[model samples]
Target: MQTAADREAKLQRHRLRMTLLSVANTSLQSVIIGLYAWAGEVGWSVAWRFFLVGAGSSAMFALIIWRGLNLRLKDPGLLLPQIALSVLIQLLFLVLAPKLWVLFLVAVLVTYNFAMMSFSARQFTLAWLLVGAASALALFAARGRFGHFGTSGVSIAILWLFFFLCIRQLTAIGTQFSSLRTQLSEKNKQLSASLERIQELASHDDLTGALNRRSFMQLLADERARAQRAGQPFCIALLDIDHFKTVNDRFGHLIGDAVLKEFCAVAAASIRVTDRFARYGGEEFMLLLAPSTSSDVARVATERVRQALEAHDWDRIAPGLRVTLSAGVSQLAPDESVEQLVRRADEALYAAKDAGRNRTVVA
Candidate 1:
């Protein structure tokens, strides 16, 4: 959910803060040394030397900051964790005082800034720990060369300051990560819901909620695949309501819509679970059969659909009204396209219409 601009803003803020913090901490050390030498302990030359050392360390630290900035441009998400750890390491080396207590400070810096942040980001935890441990070893070597007064006293003091900074940074990261994750979750939920709504709208008739003509054709394809896989047998029938136009003529469009819905309900309920039902078009419906033989399934299904609609008591809207349907049934043939199957069934339906007003035809 973070746009390029948002990420760039985050990077720029970290860059500026880290750069300034590094410079400030290093320069403060230089100032202490310079003031001592300038008070005539070691002379002007020594003071200038210490100032140069501090300035040069600040510049090197700044250069590494630039390296991380480049890595961000290349891979912000994949590389920032390591980049942040690198920057923290540079800060510790350049800033912390030479004392035994600084060992504690370095450990705090490693765990809080490097280890904690990397783990929270779900990045490299082990690598960070190893890097921190290496730094600790380096501090131990320095202590051996210089000598500790009692304990790692200087490292301890520096660690307190570093830990405080890390706590603040980690808190901010936690807030941002939580917000981003919440937004992502909400967006995914809405997307899934939208797809379900669209699927319902696209695959079913808007007026009757019956499978529409196009969707019916698609379902046939799925059926063919399934049938082919399982070696299953099935049949399909196309039916059109008789005297549908007469109902519209007598009662108008509103009443005609009610009749269509009523007919769909009957057709749906009359079919087997394995059967497919659809509105082929206005005044017409199709029934896709499953493992039923020849004209028998077609006869039973058509009869039930017709009788249910006729007996449903729609007389108050149009008294003593009677309704019937002509249906055409077809069975699946080996390696047949959906078009071929539907066409054969349609021919049969027309045959039934030609034979009589009410009957089931099979092909």
Candidate 2:
């Protein structure tokens, strides 16, 4: 068995792997943008400082997060530093290459999504504040670099507002979808439980909580087929409560019900867990021993049930009330039908009743 600590460790490792994957993907954007500028593919001068600093800082932070998570640290403050690093990196890129301002949005969106998945509300709020402040300051710094200061500032502000609104709506939708999924999952579990209970009630006896006669007969047929195919023998025992009518007449129907329940309890307790016990009909029961059980084992089990019922303290149920069981045991013959096996067991039960009241007779 795994300890709670071991399970928790496994969960932590999985979470760490997922976090690392997201971080790596996000950082790759910075590397690609930095490479584009370094190659002089864009209009901006190839400021090697900006490219090196942005890519280097993001790589360093990714390493820190990976190492910290591997060390199993649960510190919330870890992301605070990363958020500050993101803002600083964005400010560097914006001030150096004002034309690449769209990259700022990409950086913020990536971090925003990651925060929604991994960080608490407080941490996410801190990230948003850092992002917003960096954007405003970068716009002020790039006043003459991109276009007219007024037009650029207004344009940046409008774009930021739209982005914020869209992100808020997306977060709300994600939350709503998560709640619906949870509700659907719970309903599915409840429906499955109800179905299982209905199946059990349909197949089990209400009186003794055993397999009903029809289900037991079906199971007997399947077992007979399996025994014949495998060339293995099985045993069946037919058990009856001795003088049950007299008991019911003397003790009333309620006490008779109690006696039947108690007899089932005794017989059930005496049999192996692999054995099948079912109420055959009124005042009668059947037991199907496993294919591995021999006739001698079935006989011994039947005798054990008889002795248990005879020795049980029956007075607690009703004053001076006693009950006993007589059973007939039969082993399956090669290629014998289920009906033939049951008939032999039934005949042996009559022989037991005729010979005496409380003994097991084997056929």
Measured against the true structure, the TM-scores of the candidates, in listed sequence, are 0.57, 0.58
The sequence of per-residue lDDT tens digits that candidate 1 reaches over residues 1-363 is: 899989877876665555555455445444543443443323455435544654555566566666664454454333344445444443344233343234334433533453433355445665556656766665665564342333254544434545565555556557656866898999899999999989999999988889998999998898888877877767888998888999899888898898888888878887878778889999999888775345676667766776676577778667766777888888888888789999999998899899986778778
How far in Å is the alpha carbon of 86 misplaced in model 2? 37
Lowest summed lDDT over 10 consecutive residues: which window, candidate 2?
147-156
| Clash statistics: count for each candidate | 13, 0
Q: On residues 1-363, what C-alpha lDDT tens digit does candidate 2 reach at each position?
A: 899979766655654554454344444544444444444434434344544565565556556555655345555225555556656776766776676666565555555564554567786787778677877888898888773212354445544554565465456547746966897899899999999999888888887788889999999999988888888888999999999999999999999998988888888898888899999999999999987779999999888888989999999999999898788999999878889999999999999999987999999
> What would the TM-score be for candidate 2 when compared with the true structure?
0.58
lDDT of 1 at 307: 67
TM-score of 1: 0.57
Instruction: Record all residue pairs in model 2 with backbone atoms less than 3 Å apart, i.e. clashing.
Output: none
RMSD of each: 8.5, 15.9
Per-candidate Cα lDDT values, in order, are: 0.66, 0.74
Give per-residue lDDT, candidate 2, residue 269: 92
lDDT: worst 10-residue window of model 1: 94-103
